[model samples]
Target: MISSEYCRLMARYSTWQNTSLVNAADGLTNSDRWKDRGAFFQSIAATLNHIYWADALMLERLKGNGRPEETIKHSLASPSNWDDFKVLRTQRNEEIEEWAARLVDADLNGTVVWYPGDGSTRMERPTALCAVELFNHESHHRGQVHAMLTAAGAEPEPTDLSLVP
Candidate 1:
């Protein structure tokens, strides 16, 4: 079972890495950031949007909040506005940090029943494993974003977990 302390640490690392990547991405011109390089999302903006949507989706699931109507689209209906995206993403990081702080070892041992994707089906797993998957999902997408950014001629910081300080 994962301890609350471990969850908190994961949250801190996530926050740090996300902020770093965003900052690096910010250095590019809007056109450059939004350029299409033929990736899944096709553009940096779309890819980031995908990451944001995925993170938000997982957060809602982990918190027992209802899913957004749009699911994992390249654009968001709620955070559709660029300004709103920044605000919501920042808020999400804070929410994640808070959730981590509130977790307990017992909470990790408990099971979370969820649908991996759309439809009426359900699955169960240890809560901590789900939580770990939540963070891993973010990191996984961020790596994709980083690769896209680099390929677009914008250098992103190395993302080795061991590099986290």
Candidate 2:
């Protein structure tokens, strides 16, 4: 089982990395941020939107708040405006920080039942496992955003976990 400390650390690290990415992105023009760079999400804006959407979805599941009516693909199209995306991203990061601070060891031990956004099908997994998946998913997509940022001449801060403060 993952420890509460681990979850807390990942939460903080995610917030730091995300802030850095957003600040770097803000320095660029909309055209640069939205340019298709051939990544999975195609552009920096789309990739960042996807991350925000996934975070909200997973957070809802972790909290047993039930799934939203929209599918993942539909949600990924959110924060469509650059200014709105920055605001929503910051808000979500704060929400994750607060949620992590309240997590206890027991909270991570039991099974988490959630609708996987594929019609009526439901999936179950250990809470710790799901938490790790959420964090890992952020890193996986942030790497793509980081690459896209660099390709667009925006230098995001280093994302080494040990270097997070």
Question: What TM-score goes with each of the models?
Answer: 0.82, 0.93
Model 1: ten consecutive residues of lowest lDDT: 65-74
Per-residue lDDT tens digits for candidate 1, residues 9-82, read 88888887777667777777777767787888777777777777777767766776433334544445544445
Tens-place lDDT per residue, model 2, 1-165, is 688899999999999999999999999989888888999989898899889988988887788755543544565656768898988999999999998999998999888777665648878888889899989999999999998888888899999999999
- Residue 20 alpha-carbon offset, candidate 1, angstroms: 1.5
Q: Which stretches of candidate 2 lie over 4 Å from their true place?
A: 70-77
lDDT measured at residue 80 in model 2 versus the true structure, 0 to 100: 67
In order, how many clashes per candidate?
0, 0
Candidate 2: global Cα-lDDT? 0.87
